[model samples]
Target: MPELLTTSGNIALTPATFQHRLLEWYDRHGRKTLPWQQDKAPYRVWVSEIMLQQTQVATVIDYYRRFMARFPDVHALAAASQDEVLHLWTGLGYYARGRNLHKAAQILVERYGGEFPVHSLEAMTALPGIGRSTAGAIIAISTGQRGVILDGNVKRVLARLHAVAGWPGKPAVERELWRLAERYTPDERLDDYSQAIMDLGATLCKRGTPSCLFCPFEDVCLAHAQGEERRFPESKPRKVLPERQTIMLLLRNEEGRLLLEQRPGAGIWGGLWCFPQFDDREALSRWIDAKAPGAILEPAWNSFAHTFSHFRLHIVPQPARCKRTGHVSEVDTLWYDSARPANIGLAAPVKQLLNASRPFAAQPSF
Candidate 1:
């Protein structure tokens, strides 16, 4: 008999039993109709995996569909401009993913002839934004290649099942989880097994409220035995997030075209278009005097906060009416006409402000 690992009183588990039960559960209740599941092509799988990072399934569906429609393949994505890729990726947050996806696509077209190296995990990981786990997912899900994935969902499931201690973000905790992941990975049904574990995590072993009764591993989960399922995957230590302040100039020309500047390719809102920002009113005043010399400044709108992963940005939307100044014409800047807006990426807050500014622009005066 295979050596069994005891969990709760009377119940025991082995690698074989765990795999069998999980796959059985998956065959009956796993997600099958997801857009990417319909076509297990490497390109499609890769894109979906990238989009799903730090994003929920429901939110990623529409974005995935639209992105696939526009850039159907690696070659197409490689040929497209970064602006269009980022435009489709707007509202998805994590602009770095979109940027890296574009960069990787270009590399694939140039080096691999637009084909994903499905069999080589190292080759896949060498690409920008494709981590070890993500690469493993692409290989395992898209191909029948043996691959082990330890994404967030998988990490949660593993942590709880084994009653893993310490924060998963820590090196020691992660290494142990990876060891368990590798040990349990079966030799056959690579695709189904990979998806099964992920599905088990996503559906039953959810982070906040796990359906322990419905879980196949309920009898054998060490965390359930201890009656502290949520406690196994320890949370990351938290610190007070710093705050930042900025004033965005919503300068509208006589033609009602709003002034937007392209943010640098490396910092916040990278590769996206946003209203001109200033540290203070004095700096804003000087820019207006130099660039839009005769622009009329209006009272600042109600301030609000936009929180990022590390900081909270307090924004003051300062509206203005201006005439086209020659100095304002720059390659990095554009006069955005709402009626015929250019296809470009806008940060979520910027998009919301633009929608809100329509009525403001219609007013006779600022």
Candidate 2:
């Protein structure tokens, strides 16, 4: 008989029954020392959880620590400028997450007095970027409340255990995941259990080449029983990401200051700073013709390519020197001294291009 099948005092291997084995395995081997788990506060959990989305744990640790040191609490985050908040989040891609976090902090301050709205999942989810799963994480992990979470890790773990077919993104799969999540959640040791399952999935039942031998449900995992662990959590339908092309103007003044613009609150790299962009060579020429009529434009070395999850951006870098100082009447634009990096948020592609071209700017072969 399987170890899991014989455990639980002869009861069937159920969610509640499964809970004991999970917690026991967790007590012996689960992750208990994450940075977020150390402080275990709602605000901290919320920030870490948001950062962990579409991001890895090793990458989030330094960012989390630096962010906490800078903001310390919701009030600090709310009081700080959006630029300040985003500046702290440089290289942590998905700028929208930083924008939403700043917006949510402001909302929390206004409504909940910056207290994180504990004990009320509804209130927390009302804030920008705080979804049901995130709110549930904050409540359960911080406040010891019984809350069910279906984050990617938990989803993968549950999906494989039950051999749940289809992509978890589907509404039907989501409903099933929620139902199973609720069933597995226990009233006692809520915080530990929540963290345990997440840890189990993250550390053992990973997306590829999972350590099934170490998993608590190894004996009863349907996917394991059938030798289809890799096939259980079916992936989403595949589609080719669209390609986007743009020309970025890398203009510098006599003082060697680079021209940067604050992008709008929507679209790619929203709420971040970047060079003025145009569709192609013609658009770039037209913009220079209109804005900096006497500017000397020259194409940089090779173009740069940046890939987002949903699209690929092919960027043509054009370096120019404006004959005279002028201002645009459209958006908030500024001249930043390239000698000294600006303490503001820069899109990854923008930063990459800027750094790559700066040393060769004066000695350009073009």
Candidate number of the best TM-score: 1
Worst 10 residues of 1 by lDDT: 1-10
RMSD of model 2, in Å?
Answer: 3.1
| TM-score, predicted candidate 1 vs. hidden true structure | 0.95
What's model 2's overall lDDT? 0.84
TM-score for each predicted model, relative to the true structure: 0.95, 0.93
Candidate 1 displacement at residue 308 in angstroms: 0.9
Over the stretch 69-132, how does candidate 2's per-residue lDDT look in tens digits? 9999999999999988888888998888999999999988898787888777788888889888
TM-score of candidate 2 versus the correct structure, residues matched by position: 0.93
Residue 121 accuracy (lDDT) in model 2: 78
